[model samples]
Target: MPALVYLLVLMVIPLGLVIAYAFLTSGRFGGVQGPATLDNITRLFQPLYLEVLASSVVNAGLATFIAFLIGFPAALAITRLSLSWQTVALIAVVMPFWTNFLIRTYAWILLLNREGILSDGLALIGLGPIEVLYTREAVILGLTYAYIPLMVLPIYASLQRLDSMLLEAACNLGAGPWRRFRTILLPLTMPGIITGCLFVFIPSLGNFVIPELLGGGNSQMIGNLIRDQFLKSRDWPFGSALSLLVLALLVIIVMLQASAARRSRKWGA
Candidate 1:
């Protein structure tokens, strides 16, 4: 009951305000007005909103893939370590996540800019300085770095929970390393992979700080567009509609993943 109170008072109620604002009409002075209509939702279908959505999807997809590529191998290695060392390694992996996200993104900006550490390193290596900050790729890099811990933690947790005997049995049956990983290990750990992907992808899709700092306007994402509509452009209705649409898309993705997981589990059984 106490938790419920805190959740409602702190989270649900505030979210309800956003929901109400999203469905209502625009006010004369940029606030939301009642007597709502479908116009806000209709405006979300405009090419501008669609483009932002698409950019967000692509950028988030790229980031999620990169995070997976990095985190999975790391998770595998963590699981392979001595049990006593696994705890230390896991703590090290997650330590970066305790820092502020904005500061983390800014650190990347310092490293990737033309006058940044990367350029200095390049010059020392006799390679010409390269521009990096404030681009789509930079945004992807920032997001991937920011969320790697989140992805790895879940995957590592899942991998640690797995039965080692099953893997041993597969190895005894003449399964090569690649074959065992593909047929046995990958299947068992897919839930963690999916969970990690969702954790990275959903937030990346709606992320404002990384894109705003590292991507600039050139790589505007859905979250930026939504912010612009409400705060910059003062289009409350449109912003609300955009928010709802993003939430809807997230819900759909979760549902699809859930269904796929259920099917996979059934088949595995």
Candidate 2:
């Protein structure tokens, strides 16, 4: 009863309000003004908003790919370690969470900024400083750094459960390292990969902080755009619509992920 009441008060009510707000008109001064209309939803398909959505998808996709590339090997390395060492390795991968998220992002800014560590290192190597800050790549890099652990943990969980005898059997059959990984390891660990991708991709798509701090105004994503609608533009109706759109998207992605996980388990069985 308490749990149901909590859900009703916290989740249902707020979602109902947002849904109501999405249909209402925004006042000239701010807040809701008139009767509900579909204008806000219609405007979502406008070219400008569409572009932002597309770019957000692309940036998130790239971040997920990069995280996977970096994380899969890290997870494998952890799996190879002794049991005690495995715990340490896993802790190291998630150690960044011990610090504040904003602080960690600021650390990336210090490294990527002109006259910062990266630039200084380049100069020492006789290479000129590269402009990276306030760019799409910078945002992607920050996101990848922030979420790589999400990728690693899931894949590690999957890989850790794998039987060693399977690998030994594959080897005895003359399967090379690549063949063992491709035919055996890859298929078995796919659930973790999919879960990791969903974890990284969804958050990356909705994240404004990395883009705001690193992307600057030019590379604003959907989250930033929605923020602008509510704060800067004073367009509450549009903002609500955008929020609902994102909520709908998240629901769809979660469903798809759940379905994928079920399929993976079936394949594993």
Candidate 3:
């Protein structure tokens, strides 16, 4: 009951305020002032904002794809290790959490900046210094790096729970590694993959710092747009509307993930 009350006070109440602000009129100065209206929500449909929303989705999708490509194998490898090594591997995966997120982002800036280690190393190798910082690629890299642990942990937990006998039996039946994984390992771990994708994709979609610092403030995702509206432009109503839209997107994604998990369980059963 205490926890519930705390959630209501911290999360629910704030969310209710944001929703109310979304409907209320913007003050001549900044915040809520006049009667409720749909104007703020309507403004989101304008071409400029629509494009920002689309790009945010695309960038997040690309980041999730990259994370999956890297994280799945890493998680699998960790599961294959000895118990102590497994602990170490997981610690490594989650070590970034020990650091401040902003500091980690700034570290990426030091690496990707023109005068940073990457460019200097490239120049030493006789390749010309390439444009990497302030690009979509940098933002994607940052997003992937920041969220890879989110991808790995869920999948690792799933893989760890898998029955070893299934693989051994498949091997005894003349199944190759690829066949065993494809037919047995992959099917069982579908829930984890779905969960990890949800974990990575939702946060990636709303990330602002990666785009702002790594993408040089040009690559504005939905979070960045919302921040600009509320603080920079002082368009509180519009910002509140965007926040609600993101919340709605999160709810929809969670529903889709839940559906996928149910289907996976049905198929596994």
Candidate 4:
């Protein structure tokens, strides 16, 4: 009961207010004032905003894919370690979280900027001054870096829970490594993969800071658009509408994850 009340006070009330604001008219003074309307919703479908949404999805998707490519192998490697070493490896994976996020982001800026370490290294190789910072690629790289640990942890948990005997059985039955993995391991880990993808993709889609600093505003995303609407443009209604769109997307992703998890459980049974 206490937790329910807390959720109502913190999450439900705030979400309700945002939803209400999305349908209302923005006042000249920067708050909702007039009668409710669909102007904000209609505005979101404009080509300019739609393009932002599409780009955000694509960038986030790319980041999720890349993180999966890196994280799956990393997690698998960690699982192959002894228990003591596995703990150490997991610590290393999450060590970055101990530092301030903004500081870590600034470190990337130092490495990716024109006069940064990357350029300095390139100069020695006769390929100096690569323009990496403030581009779409940089943004994707930042997103992948920021969220790879999230991908790793879930997959690690899934892998840890997986039965080694199953793989041994497959091996005894004459299945090769790739075949064992494809036919047994991969299917069993689908829940974790879905969860990790959700963790990476959702945050990437709504991330504004990485794109703002890394992409130098060249890769504007839905989060940035919503922020500008509320803070810069004082268009709270439109911002709320955009927020709702993101919220809806997150809900769908979560629902899909839940559905996949259920199917996975049934398969395991």
Candidate 5:
């Protein structure tokens, strides 16, 4: 009962307010005022804002894919290690979280900037300076770096729970490594993969700081637009509408994750 009340007070109430604000008119100052209308919802369909949404999806998708490519191997490698070394490997995977996120992001800026370490190294190797900072690629890289650990943890948990005897059985039955992975391992670990992808994708879709600092504000995602609407433009109604869109997307993703998890359990059974 206490937890239910806590959720109502902290989550439900704020969400209800945001939904209400989305339909209302924006005040000349900053807050909502006047009769409710659908202008804010319609405004989101404009080509300019649609483009931002599209770019956010594409960038987030790319980051999720890249993180998976890196994280799956890392997770698998950790499972292969001895028990003591596995703990150390897991610690290394998550060590970045001990530092401030903003500081970590700033470190990337130092490395990717024109006169930074990357360019300096290129110069010594006789290669021309390649522009990386403030680009779409840089934003994607930053997203992948920041959230790859999220991908790794969930996958590692799934892998840890997996039965090694199943793989041994497959091997004894004459299945090769690739065949065992494709038939036994991949299917079993899919729930983790889905969870990991969603973890990376959702945050990447809404990330603003990485794009603002790393992409030099040239590449703006939906989160940046929402931030501008609330802070810079002071369009609370429109910002609330945009927030609703993101909330809706999150709900859908979560529903899909839940559905997949159920199916995975049934399949295991």
Candidate 6:
């Protein structure tokens, strides 16, 4: 009853309002009315919205994949270290996240811009100075940098809890290093991989802050478009519809991830 009351007070009521609005045509004056029609849903399939959705998926997927690649190895390396070193490494991974998200993204702007530290440093090394900020590549890098620790946390936790004996046993049973990783470590750590992927993907897919600050108009993402519709354009109905699309996409991703976890569990067993 307590939990139910909290849900009613918080999530349920807010979601109900959103659902109610999504079905209506948003007035030009920024109001919603309900003689429910498929207008909003149909409009969602327009090429612009479709392109935004596709871009969100691609960018989020790239961030998730790259974070996993960096995290999995880092997680393993931390586990194989001395206790003091492991603690230090874990703290290092977490420290970046403890800073403000906006500040972190802004820091990336300084690092990746043509006149910024990184590009200029590369130029000093005789490499051509690259204009990187406000580009798609920079957006992806921003996302991957911001979220890598999220991927690392779950994976490192899982790796820490894993039995080292299984690895040794696999190696002794004539399994090569690659085979051991494939047969034992990867399967055991899949729950964390799934967890980390969901963590990075959901936020990246719906993110507005980093994209808006870093992407400029040329790299406009769905999140930025949604923000523009709601706040700048004051088209609540269209924004609500787009918001619903994001919610639906999140639900689908969660369901697919849950299904993947189940399959991995079965395969592991």
Mind sharing the TM-score for model 5?
A: 0.96
Error of 6 at 266 (Å): 5.6
Candidate 1 accuracy as lDDT: 0.88
* Global Cα RMSD, each model: 2.0, 1.5, 1.6, 1.2, 1.2, 1.8
Expressed as tens digits, the lDDT of each residue in 1-269 for candidate 1 is 99999999998997787788877888877998789787777777889778889889999999999999999999999999998899999889888878887787788989999999998899889895988898889999999998888899889988987899989999999999999999998888888899999999999989888889998778899899889888888988788778888999999999988987896688543
If ranked by lDDT, best first, what sequence of candidates would result?
Answer: 5, 4, 2, 3, 1, 6
- Count of clashes, each model: 0, 0, 0, 0, 1, 0
Which ranges of candidate 5 are over 4 A from the true structure?
Answer: none
Selected candidate, larger lDDT, 1 vs 2: 2
Q: State the TM-score for model 4.
A: 0.97
The TM-score values for the models, in the order shown, are 0.92, 0.95, 0.94, 0.97, 0.96, 0.94
Tens digits of per-residue lDDT for model 2 on 195-231? 9998899999989899999988769999998888888
Q: Lowest-lDDT window of 10 residues in candidate 4?
A: 260-269
Cα error, candidate 3, residue 205 (Å): 1.2
Give me the overall lDDT of model 2. 0.91
* lDDT-better candidate, 5 vs 6: 5
Winning candidate number (lDDT): 5
Backbone clashes in model 4, listed as residue pairs: none
- Tell me the tens digit of each residue's lDDT in model 4 across 219-258: 8999999999988999899999999999998898899889
Q: Scored by CA lDDT, what does every candidate get?
A: 0.88, 0.91, 0.91, 0.93, 0.94, 0.87
Tens digit of lDDT per residue, candidate 6, span 56-145?
889989988999999899989999899999999999999987899999889888888889988889899989498888888888888888
**RMSD score of candidate 4 (Å):** 1.2
How far off is residue 202 in model 3, in Å? 1.5
| 3 versus 4: better lDDT goes to | 4
